[model samples]
Target: MTSDISHVRSLTLDEALHENPVGWFQYRLLLMCGLAFMADALEVSLLSFLATCAGADWGLSTAQEASITSVVFGGIICGTMFWGVFADKYGRKMAYLAASTLITVGGILSGASPSYGWLIFFRSVAGFGIGGASVPFDLLAEFLPTSHRGQFLIYIEYFWTIGSMFVAGLAWATLSQQGWRFLA
Candidate 1:
């Protein structure tokens, strides 16, 4: 009986938000979520550059280099399933923040890695954090009015392209001149 009331109340809240005019809340959400998307893309772009640099610096074999890069994908696969469940049990915002933190810590640790083995471990950690894309993709839509949701989602996606370009330029400017550790 009470459960039914809870469900209806939740729907009512969603209804009210949908009816609300487009304003700062929606815009702010767009900015934050877009940044997340951009960061995810940047991290992915950085991987190839970083992996190549690491390979040369560490004198790694082709298979070892590939393994270092491929491990991140494995982590992402596991993290998606893990983070999706985590968001459902906890909340999207919480999961997103946690994932962002993981990405940051993992990235820092990866940059500081002394060997190929450590790099593989840290990159996988970052990849796991990357899997928490649920919040950016799903949460934004829930808050947005149906009329504007499509445009906003599209806007959010544009950041990915920008991030890739930014990384490419950054890599071009620095990777050739500096050591991998500096760029990493």
Candidate 2:
């Protein structure tokens, strides 16, 4: 019993992560997470501002405009559920990569949409990708030192607010001057 006890080692996840000083890897993780939050904010808010412009350009009724805007939310709901499950089954990095691909492809297709139906479909695809944004916060928290964990998450969330503001400014500058396509 004494010999067996001497051979055993204990190195828990808490000890391994929390005992180390914050380093480049942690900082990179934070930056990546912050950027995901920013992209989510930008994509969500861009739809809201563009709704009015797109409606006018397409000569759509209020209901149609609302439907176009709301489809993204529906996509978000599905995406959140699907990606959440996928992340649990697989890994966060794989989920992030797949989601990011969906978002990029969706955005490009949305911009090239030749009809209202196509626009809705592509935006929904983009919304699905946006769902991946939820994973990073959890991933980032695990890597953060316990002492600063909560505060750092709060600070990282501010990137969403910044992203919202940025899109608003961008919309004002480009949407009005260059038209909706340029903004998209």
lDDT of candidate model 1 versus the reference: 0.83
| Residues 97-181 of candidate 1: C-alpha lDDT, one tens digit per residue | 8888877777788889977889899999989998886667777887887888899999998999998999888888887777666
Clashing pairs in 1: none
Clashing pairs in 2: none
TM-score of each: 0.90, 0.91
TM-score of model number 1: 0.90
lDDT of 2: 0.83
lDDT of 2 by residue, 67-104 (tens): 87798888889999999889889988788778878877
